[model samples]
Target: VEAPNQTIAIEQSQSDRSKKTFHPVKVDLPGDQITKVTLGRLHFSETTANNMRKKGKPNPDQRYFMLVVGLYAVSQDQFYLLSANVSEKIIVRASNPGQFENDSDVLWQRGHVPETIVYHGRVGINTDAPDEALVVCGNAKVMGRVMHPSDSRAKQNIREVDTNEQLRRITQMRLVEYDYKPEFASVMGIKNTHETGIIAQEVKEFLPQAVREVGDVACNDGEKIENFLMVDKDQIFMENVGAVKQLCKLTNNLEVRIEELEQWNRKLARLKRMSSLKSTVSEESKVSRCSRATSLLPSKKSVPLKSNKVKLCSVKIFRVTIIALIAIMALCALTISTLCLLSVHDRHFEKHPIYRQVVELVTSSSVALSPSTTTAALQGESTISQSTQPVSRIPEVNFCDILPCDKVYCCPIHLQKVKFLNYEKTNAKEKRSRCHCINCNFIMLLSKISEIIKKKTLFLIFLGIDTTISSIQILETQQSIDSRYCSKNLQCRSGNYTYVIPINKYTPMDVEISLEINTTEPLIIFLCKVTFGNYCSPYSSSQNSRKDFLETTQGRQHIWTLPVAKLYDSAYYFRVAVPGFASCSTDPYFAGIFFTDHYFYFYRQCN
Candidate 1:
């Protein structure tokens, strides 16, 4: 009969008793399609049945089960099903599972649908046996950051890196560009594109900490594991940082050293400039002295002597008597002049207290004459000469005529060795006369003063005067004395053979020749006045040139104020030659000529 709403009916059904079966009662529902049957007294509640009926469609929060045969128990308001077993496997499959179905092995599956998976044990993806908590055999694309433990507590034996060592090792590492192999690319799921990185093998040689060996698990089979080298990019980056720091320190040190060298170069330039100025001043002074000496000599054409002749031949006896009387008066006058000059020379040297003091100072210390002593000596000698002879007669004495033309005469007080540039040509009588001349003595004093100035440069500095400042003051002082004073310097290099430098017509006639030589060998310097041609040799006779020999035992700088005669011609030449059998040095020696424009002759005779 059909079941409609909820009406139920019970009827007794007859069964055959021939097979030992008995008749059973049957209950049937007529209205509702749901059927409920119970073997013993029914204990099912209406509320629990109604709840099960409401959940009949589908609910993820609750579990639903269909059993063919099971024991059910109801205690208080709870419903429980006692022991149930399935005949085969049990699987819960998705509604539209694709390529996967319920099987004896898989317990659950969600197919292509995205869902959350939570597991307490290890999980391996694309790998059958995972060695870690989570293992991915191929490349993984992560949308979030992948973090590793980096706390200080996790590390041990931390220390600072040596930047210098790191820099050296980094220089040794070789960087390379290469493409991944097909097999490697396929296993790693990466494209076979060119990549830039340091070679792991090369880096291991210098910086092993930056390199490591890693297994190529994707390419390896289960039987054997294959390994390859890998370089850690982070380690290289750290090394580069340390290297940069070391380079900065080295650059700073180089900058400081460069600055120090620049300062020294500037100082040397200043000193060179000062030396040039001093040489110029000295040359000018020499030129002036020669010019004054030339001007002081009286020209033979300027003054003419007139003679008157008497007719004494007509009366020989009368003329003879008058001539005898004149001759006798002339002899008496000559004897008186001789005695006066001899007494003056002795009195000047012996009686003067200042002269005595100067003699003592020179003999004791061997120091050259000072400027003050030179001035006093000149003034005292001029006074004595004026007292003994008339002013007009003093000028006629011809001071330059008596001076030794071949030698530099120094004062006899110190008795220093006399250096003769040429053979002496003056007679003994002339030498005696020169010693007696006031002008000759003054010239000797001036020469000594020039020597003192040259050798006592350090002494001037010790007295709180720098050489440059003292030189400038001397220039100013001399300029005040004579405005015509000027100077020039001629520089050249000398070798084993002779080197010549020409002096132009514009050069001063009284120019002083100061030679400075830098060499290790002996050298001879000559000042020659060309008489006829443009050429003048250092080996020329004393009539044309004056020469001085300089011998040196060591490599040193030598300066000499050459004792040259007064320049008679408008043009001259300077000749330098290395003396002796020594070969020329690889390096050329330096030679410089300083021409000073000042009247040294007039300064001695007048001042």
Candidate 2:
């Protein structure tokens, strides 16, 4: 068969296995006008077909025939095969000269040619249908990197990622080491080795963009084709980058805060040193003042005779004047008493003869002694000698005269409950007899001074400095009392102690309790949340009881974090107890409990 623009060559081999040559067969058919052809008598003999079938070879004896069709173009040095079937068209061409030796090599040459091959539609390998531009159904080995399109112009709606949220989500993700099932592993050509990765389901919960649904090719367990959730590791890696950036920012902030705290600690140390030095100086000054006051007191040998005589004369004059004043007070009191009696019993005394006789006798005695008494008083005055030095008299002052008697002195409205006394001012001069008002200004000043002093003293005590003059027993007793009354609902006692922290409705539900404890021995800590006004007991049936043991040495510090699922208007109690037969009464333990929100902002203490 032949055509005007194409040539067809037909060859047939004899039934001998050793024969390598073929004989040409010619058919008288027009190829240009006829689009189809049928050859009914072109078949092998019975013996040849039987031999080929028994050997499982189509042409073991070279008895089969071959058909070679070729199309040649004048402008190109290549051979092409074209197929147009069911509205689909395909064109395969071989341009390599070495492929002409074997006709089968020409079909394989299409893939190996050193030229760019472009596909207008999807291309699939080992797959009947592909849903992507290029898909490989089985494992593929690449010697080089495969890059995806990452040009800025190809992307839209690009924005920055929220690194904080990324960090939070990343923290919530659970990492797992898993091995693929045997059937799936064999189908996917994957080795049964432990692999570390995040679960696609869990990743989807936190970051949906990192997970997607993909058709599983290893679904051979009597199940239909199923879509499996697959995780995009690249997306996870990008999210990890953002999370690391956020972590770096947090680390930097923490470093800054630590530095600031260290600075404050240094300042506190310096202030404490200064305060200690001031206390020492004040003690030395007090000793010196006492010594100077003792030295200023005059001794018996140091006083002069003239001064002694003057003191004696002054004493004598003071005694005589006191005696005279006493006599005058007595006479005046008697006269006043007589007048009061006479006025009350005027009628009764007038009718009584004895009362009249007594009154007349008292009047006659007074009349008889008036001249003698005057002469005696003059004689007494003449006998007393006056001191040469005129003494400066001290004016007497009344209690109400010095104070604000007209109006009450009170603190400000805000501080009216605070009590203050003006005990420093004992006396006031008569010339300056005015009401002295202790106003709010003076009270506020005093309060501020007291506060400052109290703060300084507490600071000193906290630093283990014994600034007070109290005895050790006194200090210990005071400390025990303070510990007993440290909190309203909880009291520190021997053996074990329970501290309750009230979580009001205003507190955030999602918060954490952080404990920083310094202990001298091993301690057991119990934490739980209960209804309001309830205590957390060891044997109680409370929910969410977080119990932990703190194994520590002398002065060893430990930090713990407990995530609190607080209910509204609940009370959370964390108890600290000694392990086994130990007790906390013999030794003091320090604990700082901090309540923080989800973001770790401290707002309250475990008071």
For lDDT, the strongest prediction is 2
| TM-score per model over all chains | 0.29, 0.32
The runs of at least 3 residues in candidate 2 whose Cα sits more than 4 Å from the true structure, single-residue gaps closed, are 1-143, 216-225, 280-607
lDDT of each: 0.39, 0.40
The ten-residue window of minimal lDDT in model 1 covers 465-474
lDDT (tens digit, per residue) of candidate 2 on 1-607: 1122432232233355322223332334466675454332222222112122345533333222223433333336553444322211111122121222222212222223577443456777766567777777556889999898999999999999899998998899998899876666554456645688888888888688888887755444644446778788888888889999999999998986687568558768887888899889867855665555445556555558447655655665577579879997676566456445533444332333222222222223222212122212211222112421111121111123223334211111231121221122323583255223334334443464475475443353243321111111111112111222122212222322332222221223333444454443333433322222112222232533434323332212435443332321122233344333222331221122111100011111111
Stretches off by above 4 angstroms in model 1 are 1-156, 217-225, 279-607
Instruction: For candidate 2, list the clashing residue pairs, or say none.
Output: none
**Every model's Cα RMSD, please?**
33.7, 31.6
Candidate 1, 136-225: lDDT as tens digits:
756678999967678999999999878999789878877789997665555555664578877777888888877776554555333333
